[model samples]
Target: MADAAALPSEALTPPGGGPGAGPGPGRAEGAEGLFVVLGAGLAAASHPLLYVKLLVQVGHEPLPPTIGRNVLGKKVLYLPGFFTYARHIVKVDGKRGLFRGLTPRLISSTLSTVTRGNVKKAFPLEDMEHVSNKDDMKTSLRKVVKETSHEMMMQCVSRVVSHPLHAYVSVLLVISMRCMVQFIGREVKYSGVFSAIVRIFKEEGILGFFVGVVPHIVGDVIFLWCCNLLAHFINTYAVDDNFSQASVIRSYTKFVMGIAMSMLTYPFLLVGDLMAVNNCGLRAGLPPYAPVFTSWIHCWRYLSAQGQLFRGSSLVFRRAPMQAACFPID
Candidate 1:
């Protein structure tokens, strides 16, 4: 029952406290991996729900100032759907229910926005109007392609880097506030914005902030390379009608991109999630409770007949060759 830390390098001592131990490590390390994969599927697959929620919140919810604003100056908002549902549920359950995963979502949202913004600036793939002004179709097209690729890569890396935070936060949103409190006990109350910041700094130190960063960078970078760029590309070439479907097309594009992004970067997200869970998300945070498979099954159950959500995902790549001239969606 010796302390594993004190034990010899090669020895495998008793876990938490056999005779002379403290805490034990079991499947804790592997837990986040499951969340990452599960999280991506949940986000990617149920995108319509997310969009619908956002639409409702922007129309009829009490949230931070960023709802319909093009730029959320200092918003403290949740994802559109989760927040909407949460607000309704909280009306019945109280404040605890409405803001369950506030911390991780805040962190992840900031990171995603920053990542997307920077990548947009760096690549500006969607700004083909400026880049293509030279009137040289061949040159303009090549430039667009390169810029799009670059944007995708940047977005992918950013998403990967931010995956654990996203996954942790999403799980927090899924579980009820009462359940979270039951599981986390005293720590939950102490984990507000100020407390979480100080705790992470003290416990993880500077090195801790970068937890799961590498794997996420890899995963998200690839995610952007595929899906996000597809959005930018769709904007650039395909389905260029100035009508109602334009918005629909964009939404559908984001959905497809979300799936592609999720599929390609899932393993990386899984690795990152595993790291976050092991670091004390279960007791100290909102994730680490839900199993990976269960979440996917949950997503599919609700994803049956959403109409336009999954409409163009399969044809996302196919749009490329035809992109020289867009085909009518109607």
Candidate 2:
């Protein structure tokens, strides 16, 4: 009786507690707790309008590490997995398929100018030309535009160079997610998160990766457009020197902005999610002249499910690292 009682007490007490033990269960639980907190916290901290709002109002201690990464324009996650999936678009879909979303990429790049691109820094030096006219506005404008173009070029180069691995993981993960979710109601129980990864390795061999590319391209292009457009509009219109910088207000506003963006562009992401399953990568995933409503609704349901599964850069087995400072209002 005493031994049984001790088992329950010890379980409640945490893993490595008896006065002599170091951290075992306690540490594991703490780590998981920390991860959950960080996940939510990182999302908020990297959120600019929120960060600005907090700064203006509460005088918070400081932003989280993710926020710092955002300001510095460095992506925190490696997501070594998804990049592998990128190759499938190249290998199976051919050259055009590999770069399927070029138009969206261009659109994303142009919209990016509003926030991170700051191409305005060049063209409209009228706002701050008095501070330093040592450089001509045209020169400044040229440089900024050139830099923005260069950034886009750099991304393309990187994608091309790392095409193989990126294709592999990305393709596999996308298909795997759709499959697992469909398999959700069955006895296999969708294999949980960490194990889903391991199971991918065991079951699909090295080839499970190509399946994820189409979904990734779809999700990313739409996500970029939505996120960038709203952020751009907010900065261009809503944000200004006076009231726009409030941290709490900005934080909440950013959250809402992200949500609005999500809702608006979610269907595209949904289509991407569904199309990811058919990723032999041989053809463009979308069919020509398909019934608009059927495709859209189909995309929406799948996307909604996936969104619930991987909310805000959060994914189960694979993840997209928080991108560069996406929406910096004012």
Candidate 3:
């Protein structure tokens, strides 16, 4: 998923007044800290949903599908929704279990945020000028293109620098032994984070830490370019400056556009997550549950063929796949 905090919608300017001055150094630092804290808090709060989503993505459906009605009021077999799936997790491992693998995720988010900020500071945009809608259409368009290009460049550089941390987190939380312990039937191997890291290194070596990074970076780049370009065009051409709620409308536009673009790029994320876990020693990554993918391309092709690219995109109102539904429920 795209990190809203790291988006280049607004440039980070140094303290004091300029054409479009940003917050001062101390204030900026404090704000970044608050962002990290709030981000971590949100991650902790939403961990359960993500936990269930990951399991579902890996085809680890411990609970059977239940009868439910769709939005159309048609009767259908629905896989366990968030509450049902979460309740099962609580039953098996208590409330604390819902937070499994959260530590690495939090750390990852914080590191990414900090690293991006520092990198941006190190390579600040030169002659940073705010593009005004008041300017002539051709001039505004030119400025927007220039600014957007700079922003995308900065985003790519920051992403490359910070991606190792992201990869590490994916290793620990997506397909690693640490995350597998959250599943009910998986055998407990490594007891904690440090031990799990050591074991992965011993078995899979350094490459193990970077399993799903390529697709992830690609997804982020695609998302950033699409979302940023579209938002700039809308805000520049579509939204009128004289409108009273112009800012509000533009904000909503960016949010909604980001979501739409995310859906389009979601398959990249799905493939990345699957590759991270594939053939990684857990049953979830092994045969019957999943095939031994030679590379992310193979995984992508398999998922595309199975029409399971968006397997865990929705948490609530999940419908079982036809093949899964055909199997006799225990």
Candidate 4:
């Protein structure tokens, strides 16, 4: 997912203008609208992978494990990969099933982007051109810290504002009659968004809409800091001075760094999503799949003990534990 909260400072600055020249209201609104559309499109395209991944995360293994050779050439149980899981979903719910829960995901993406843009306008970061221009180590470090801090604050505020929508998406993904229940067995089925919202409010109360928000925010913060700091250091010190002239390469460095940081911080995201649906009445969230957790921390500890903190992270080459061993082949 795009880090809507961490929109580049240059994006907020108007073309042919400096940091002092704020983006024109019309231009800013247009840019945000464009991003909303783009985000929705991206979410739609990626929904299948996310759907299958979420089911995997919740321990809903419909397909039996198959025996495969590990990297070490030992017989090991390999869980269904992304394509296998997706094909199974199609078999059950048809092609349209892959897009289940997309409505709320699009809404969440839009709200997050708009909220971040508005919050950024209200609390614009100070321009660091002077600090950034200086090649001194201390100045570069200071600039990075300032930039990361601004990003962290914006992300946290936006997350808090739009988190209820995220919770809604999680519930929808896990309880929709046409989606989640198709994998984990029919338990509780929500008809539509409004009905689901009312039921969640009644069953889980107001707190239901904010479940697992803390860890999500923390993960974002950590990703921002790590990605920004490392990118800054690499661009400033590690790369050749001439490398800065390659604007295209320089631009991609941050994206690559972000991906790396995301992998490192993915466990937090997994825990956050797990906690959002845990004990929320879906069979996937209840006993036999997962135990009731006292807190997100407890959820984290439980998954850690089971070595499942990274479950569903990989779409392919998923090696299951020996305890789950099945269908061994010579």
The lDDT per prediction is 0.39, 0.32, 0.65, 0.69
**TM-scores for every candidate against the unseen true structure:** 0.40, 0.31, 0.83, 0.85
Report clash pairs, candidate 4: none
List per-candidate RMSD values in Å: 20.7, 22.5, 4.6, 4.4
Tens digits of per-residue lDDT, candidate 3, 1-330, equal 422332332332222322223457877777777766776787678767777777777777888888777788777788888898889988988998787777666665566666666666776766534354556657766765776666666666654544433322234433232364336444565445576667667888877767776777677777766776787778777888789988777666656777777777777777777777777666667777779999888988999999988887788778888876675543
Look at candidate 1 and tell me the lDDT of residue 300.
Answer: 27
Worst 10 residues of 1 by lDDT: 1-10
Residue-level lDDT of model 4, residues 1-330, one tens digit each, is 322222333222222432224468777677667767776787678777877877887888888878778778887778889899899988987998787777766666677778777777898777655233334879778877887788788778777766676554453322322234335655445556677778778988877777888888888877888787777777665566466565555556677777667677778888877787777766777888889999999999999999888887787888776677644466
Q: Candidate 2 residues 244-294, lDDT tens each? A: 454334334434554555554433433433333332222222222111223
The residue pairs found clashing in candidate 3 are none
> lDDT winner among the candidates?
4
Q: Kindly report which residue stretches of model 2 are placed more than 4 angstroms away from their true locations once superposed.
A: 1-37, 40-172, 175-179, 182-208, 240-255, 277-330
Scored by Cα lDDT, where does model 3 land?
0.65
| lDDT for model 4 | 0.69
TM value for model 1: 0.40
Candidates 2 and 4: which is better by TM-score?
A: 4
